[model samples]
Target: MLTVELGEELLIIKSEQPLKVLSSAMLNPGIGRYQYFVNRTVDKNYYPEDAKCEYEQFLQQYTMPLQMTVAMMTAVQQRFVMREQYVDGETTIDVFITAGLGNAVDVTQSYQYTYKPAVGTINIFVFVDGDMSDEAFIQAYHCIIEAKVKVLHERGVIDKQSGTIATGTSTDSVALAVKERGEFHAYGGSITRLGALIGKGVAATLHKAIDGYDAYQKGELR
Candidate 1:
């Protein structure tokens, strides 16, 4: 590690022989007299401006879909209260719209949360990243809620201490959903993070498509 003092900031460069390389550095008069390579041993080179243009073009595709996703989140939060502190830490996504296929109506926004108590009358927070259509969102949501509730019930996430049906103001988990229809929904419905996983099913489809009719033998793809 070697520190070279730039005009304002010091940049640390890693090299086997920093001082020797710096001594033989050539000051290229491009944009500014910035020494990109320590020595004249760079395999290839291009003008900085050219490289910048290429990078900017490459980044344009990712910008729109990510932006669309987040913008929808903000709008949804105003009406539907979801998991508080959604999209916290870990992987923070920045989505921008790539394209809206036909009448698909870009309802691609989503958010996630992990409530501590996980049940009872509580507000589930959501952090969205795009604008969503109300019709599509509701349709997807109700389907998910019903499916999850059934699965959760079968999986024993909701069951009374007694063997009989839970009734008479003794709503534990089911009551939570009834009270907070928009928030704290049981199981996952539309507009849930599970959709993200489902979205990635495209990758699996592509893999299968590309590898279809493969000639594999001896535990190796051919």
Candidate 2:
């Protein structure tokens, strides 16, 4: 079973079974300055010695619960936090995003200037209730990335060269949780709807984050 909690300054996901954190980025410690923030906030002692070196265990034990708090407290804090719940008949998809863009950039301009190490970070977590296959997971990931880039572009945060999202290092991350089915094993039923909902939710959440960035730039928000 999967559980969610929204606290005064944190959002947490508690699960009975171990969940996977899958992304091309290095979320184990995050990237650049974001990496330092995660390292400072996470309780390394939380994990057993045996699991200390394991990335997945570290996330489940440390990052998932503590990173939110850390992001909230950091000086160049995360500007936006959004959560969306999508329901289609019996299936449900929940999307969560936390964006920190202090190192944001225009992908087009990346090549022109010798920039610093890591770029901004976006943490996306998706929870689903349904059965799915490995292939479906890959395709769904593609959908999430596309939607994220689209939202960045629509909100005027794209790279000048790529015309997509600004290029970054191993900072962005994603966590996908799926529920298991009973005796009769079947798949491919929820991918399409789940993908659509996840995409829309992620895009909308990112837009909100962009709004915060705009406000900060205008000195309306801190």
Tens-digit lDDT track of model 2 for 68-153? 32221211243245667776656677776766565556655667766544435666766566655666666666777777767766
Per-candidate clashes, comma-separated: 26, 2
TM-score of every candidate: 0.21, 0.63
Candidate 1, residues 105-222: lDDT per residue as tens digits? 1111111222221112111111122223344334333442243333233333322333322111111111010111123322234455533422222223222322321212123433
Candidate 1: segments with Cα more than 4 A from true spot = 1-119, 147-151, 161-222
The total number of steric clashes, by the backbone 3 Å criterion, in model 2 comes to 2
TM-score of 2: 0.63
**Candidate maximizing TM-score:** 2
Reference-based lDDT, each prediction: 0.22, 0.52
Cα lDDT for residue 178, candidate 1: 13
Highest-scoring model, lDDT: 2
TM-score of 1: 0.21
